[model samples]
Each structure stands twice: as structure tokens, then as C-alpha cells.
Target: MSAGDLSGRRALVTGAASGIGRACAVRLVEEGAAVVAVDQDADGLAELAKTVDVEQSVVDLSQLNDVDRLDLAVDIVVNNAGLQHVAPIQEFPPDRFSYILRVMLEAPFRIVRGALGHMYAGGWGRVVNISSVHGMVASPYKAAYVAAKHGLEGLSKVIALEGADHGVTSNCVNPAYVRTPLVENQIASQAKAHGITEDEVIERIMLERAALKRLIEPDEVASFVAYLCSDAASSITGSSMRMDGGWTAH
Candidate 1:
């Protein structure tokens, strides 16, 4: 309840079996908050549970019904589950677009909408959405992803204004191309889509816009998320915190 610690807090983190979500689960636990790890990957959740004492919820967030089934009474909600599809706008499949938005945007909206009551009652809470650099800007061949992130930013802002009096802060952490399995998969997809090698995808495409010239590790982003969740950042609501390696500096 105080700055720098989460002794009695409970956090619900989606996509928690791996990548940034996994790192967040570990870090928040280290900060003393109990975590409920949610993901569609049953095997990965089992693996994560083997290492940490977390309640595992194996639900496909794309399934709105399953999202509703989740125990929504928690002090923190980290909406980090996502996927990407790279294609020119004209070639983008309508179904894929809808699917991405359902998982990335609609699911978060539902989770936060359901969880707000408990947070408001408790008079304290945090909603840390793991958005991407695309949330602030855009890139070719990622129409659906870009749209979903953009929507997420707007959702965070609205939540901030409404939750301010209730002590619930909603914010987005925008990082550029993190070193995660998702990004790794994107590299392969990009390489094929662009007719280049994976190394070229990383160097000439992914890192091209980033001044840091390297991928961001999941722990680094997770650390920032933990900070936002801490009492130290009670004033930092409805803000988009970018860890984009100066990608937006352009």
C-alpha cells in the first residue's frame, strides 16, 4: 500500500506464461504481490507455476466469455497478451484484424471494466497496459496491430480520468520491439513478408528505427511496469510511458 512495496496487493497479468508478461509476474512477486498468471498456453503456464507460486488461469483471452470467467477482484491488472500479423492494408485479412483487436483491445476493456468495481471499492489500484511503440505512431504492413494499440492508448486515458478519484491509475508502457518470443516470431514473419533474412529483419527493419540499435529485454520493461504499480507513481495516471529507445524521437 506504500511506496516501493506491494505486500498485500494482488496482480492479474495476462500473457504471463512467457515474454514481458512472464517477467512482470516474477518482478511483482519479488515486490511481494501475489500474482494470477493468465494465458492460453497451458504448458507454458505449468512451466511458470513450477518456478513461482502463482494462480494459473488458462484462458484464451480472445474468447470474451473466458475473459468474463476470470476472477476480476484484484488490485492490479496488466493487459499484456497480444499477437501480430504483418501484411499490407489491402492484403490484411478482415478476420485476423478482428481477432487481433478482440484480443488486444476488447479483452482489456472487458477485464478493466469488470475489475474497476473492486479497485474503486478498495480505493487503490493499477492498470498497466503493455502497449507498443505503434500505439503512438504507425508502421506499414501492420494495420491491425497499429489500430489496436492506438485504441489501447485512448482506453487508458479514459480510465485514468474516471479512476483518478478512486485511486486507480491506468497507464500504458510503450516499448519498441522487445526481445520476446512474440517479437522473435514477428522477425520470421517480417523476413518472409519482406523477402529478407531474419538478421536483416532485426537489423534493417526492427532496429532500424530504434536509436538503441538493440532489442529491449523483457525484465527492463517489467521493471518500469513495477515502478508504475508502486505507490511512487500514484500521480502518473493516464500517461503513455515509452521505453521505445528513442524511436519516437523522430
Candidate 2:
């Protein structure tokens, strides 16, 4: 199918307020898809709705009941909502750990489950999980985040296998650290955690972790996600597309 073949199709994106979610929503609309933008930030959702033909919903994805409340039957679901907490396993708060899993893993499961009947009846659908390079490798101070992402990858693969005959494809997009507000805030967060300056956090922490020595852009990840959701990606399922700039190469 052509790049512009998304006309009349509907897509729902979590975390649509900012970062990769915002970029993906914009890109999907540009390719002719009607979008449902979901986020906890009502202000951000309002801004996003003004930019496209989007149905905006303000819901906290960490709550399973919130996922159940979405009533639309869309052609695609992008589970992009997530959180990052930095702490050693010994220092990590149990509540924070639970929150991360609920948002990153449990919520995706619920959203996919809720969309299944609709997708199966329609005979076509796509589920794109916005995972991370941490999903593939280990990182210090990201215990809960990494674990949830890893679980999300495994869950996507299973859905791909189970949904194939029904014409529903499930896959993941794993990108290295991107230059989003989330990552930018990490400069301060990591610096405080490590007792270093923001410059040191960027140079000695983040850049050092990446092979490319550069942070990824949200648009780059968005384009890859948009491609995966397109009809051209029909043959692609149960796979992890790495946009990690070779971070996992080592």
C-alpha cells in the first residue's frame, strides 16, 4: 500500500501529549488517518487536538479501569504512554515500581485486549508498542522501567503470533534515548542521582551509553512507528525494530 493509504482509518495513541506520542500522532494525521489522542495532560491533549482531526481523551493509563473506558474501535493502537524512575533496586520505591508496570505493561495488555473484538470483527488491525533499547539490554538505575519494557516486548510477540490469522499485527519500536522533554529532564534527574552536574550527566552518562554519542530525535522514532502502522508493514509482525543507533550492538 502507498504511504497515503491511511485515509479513513482510525488510530489511537497513548501519551499523545508530548515526545514520541505527539510526533507519531502528527505523522499519522499527515498520512490521512483520523487520530484519537490519549493523555493524562488535558492541556496538552487540547493542543494536540487543534493540530489535527483528533479525538482527545484525558485518562491516566496507569489505571486499568481507564483503559477499559476507551470506547472507540480503531484500526490501530499505539501504546506509547510510559514513565521512567531512576533508582537502584534496593532504593527503588515499591509503589513507583508498581506504577511503572501498570502503565507500561499492564495498560498495554488491557488496551490490546479491549481492541481485540473490534479488530477481529473488522478483520484488520495493528498494535505498536513503543518500547526502548533498555527492553533489550540492562541499565543501571532503571530497574522497573527496563523490566516493564522487556515484558512489553514479549507480550507484543505473543500477540503477533495469536493475532496473525485474524489480520492483526503486533510489533515494537525500540529506540535509544531520544531528545524529548523526558530525556532532557533526565539531565537533572541523573545528575542529582549521581551527584554530578547536568553536563556530566549528558556527557558521562547518556552519551556514553549510546554508540552514536548523540541523542535520537522524536521525529525519527515517529516515522519508524508510522511506517510500522502502515499497510506496507503487513508482513512485519512479532519483531522489534531497533532505532538504537547501535547501542545494542555492543
Q: What is the C-alpha RMSD of each candidate to the true structure, in Å?
A: 1.8, 1.7
1-250 in candidate 2: lDDT tens per residue? 2345788788999999999999999989998888899999999988888887788899998877878999658889999998899888999999999999999999899889888888899889999999999889988889999999999999999999999999999999999888888998888877887999987887787878667878889989888888887778899999999988888887
Per-prediction count of colliding residue pairs?
Answer: 0, 0
Q: What is residue 147's positional error in candidate 2, in angstroms?
A: 0.9
Model 1 misplaced regions, further than 4 Å: 1-3, 192-196
The count of backbone overlaps in candidate 1 is 0
Estimated TM-score for each candidate: 0.96, 0.95
Per-residue lDDT, model 2, residue 120, is 90
Following a full C-alpha superposition, what root-mean-square deviation does model 2 have from the true structure?
1.7
Across 1-250, the per-residue lDDT of candidate 1 in tens digits comes to 2237798999999999999999999889888999999999999999998888899999999899989989999999999999998898999999999999999999999999999999999999999999999999999989999999999999999999999999999999999989899999888887998999998999898889888988999999899999999988999999999999989998
Worst 10 residues of 2 by lDDT: 1-10
